[model samples]
Target: MSVTDILRLGPVMPVLVIDAVEHAVPLARALVAGGVRVLEVTLRTPVAFDAVRAIRAAVPDAVVGVGTLTRPDDVAAARAAGAAFGVSPGAYPALLAAAAQAGLPLLPGTMTPSDVMTVRAAGYTACKLFPAAQAGGVGMLKAMHGPFPDQLFCPTGGIDAASAPGFLALPNVACVGGSWLAPKALVQAGDWPAITALAQAASALRA
Candidate 1:
């Protein structure tokens, strides 16, 4: 699927950091149960690939992806693990090449006009505004809209339920990425029901 198609799968894409491989399927099931199917599992832990494989095998309805991709090998590994897509904190030439080579769709991150231009030059119109709050949040998106009206964004980082609506309200935003839907405490407690509730609330947000 295209990057835009993935972004359109739900109102909010949960930025998950699954520490335990065992939590992967249950967490994915919870999110899917609540109408949130686009899951981005960050490669920040040892068992991340395993978690991805588990979720892919168990949750057919969920569109599983890998995040925190920084290297060419990361792209290969994510593709091997059956990630439908990949996300990075920043766009790089090698990473872009590797993603293209692996036939993996990527939502590369951008924090400035230059960064946007770089990705745009590489033929990407959809991108992630990483560290969104620190990069001026809604105001930055507005400014970007004026120059790159055709560009679409999935603004991530420092966003929560309270502020997601404002970001979604923007004409340029296709959706948002958030970590609050699966908080560490809830995940650690194995509170799938609570996570499902959070996902339900997030899924209801409108653009």
Candidate 2:
């Protein structure tokens, strides 16, 4: 599926950080069970790729993708590991070119109109707004909407349940990426039910 389609599949995509490879399957299952199917597992841990492969094998319903992609090889590696799509905190010329040619759906990051335009010029209509809260949150998105009406965004970084509703209420936002659905404490404790509950709440924020 295209990046836009993946974004549209759910209202919120959990920005996950899995520390253990063994936690992959159960965690994905809990999120999917709670009504969220789109999952972005950030490559911040050593077991990231293994976790991606594990989730793909264990969870049929979850759409697992790789995040924190900073290099061209990361794209190829993620595709080989069966990532449905890829996300990065920011964009680079070579990285964008490689992902485009690799046919990997990528949501490169953007925090300003110029960044959005640059990604758009490279033929991407959807992008992620990194550090969304610090980048002016809803107001920044609102301002950009006037100029880039066709742009689609998934704002990530420092967003929580309380602030998510405001972000999702915006017309330019497709969804918001957050880590609250599967907090490190919850994941480490193996609290699937609690995670599912959080996912349910986030999924309900579809405005």
Compared with the true structure, all predictions reach lDDT values of 0.96, 0.94
Q: How does candidate 1 score on lDDT?
A: 0.96
Question: How many clashing residue pairs, candidate 1?
Answer: 0
In model 2, where is the ten-residue run with the lowest total lDDT?
A: 198-207
The local lDDT score (0 to 100) that residue 161 gets in candidate 2 is 96
TM-score of 2: 0.98
In candidate 2, stretches whose alpha carbon ends up further than 4 angstroms from where it belongs are none
TM-score per candidate, chains pooled: 0.99, 0.98
Off by over 4 Å in 1: none
Superposition error at 184 for model 1 (Å): 0.7
Q: Candidate 1 versus the native: TM-score? A: 0.99
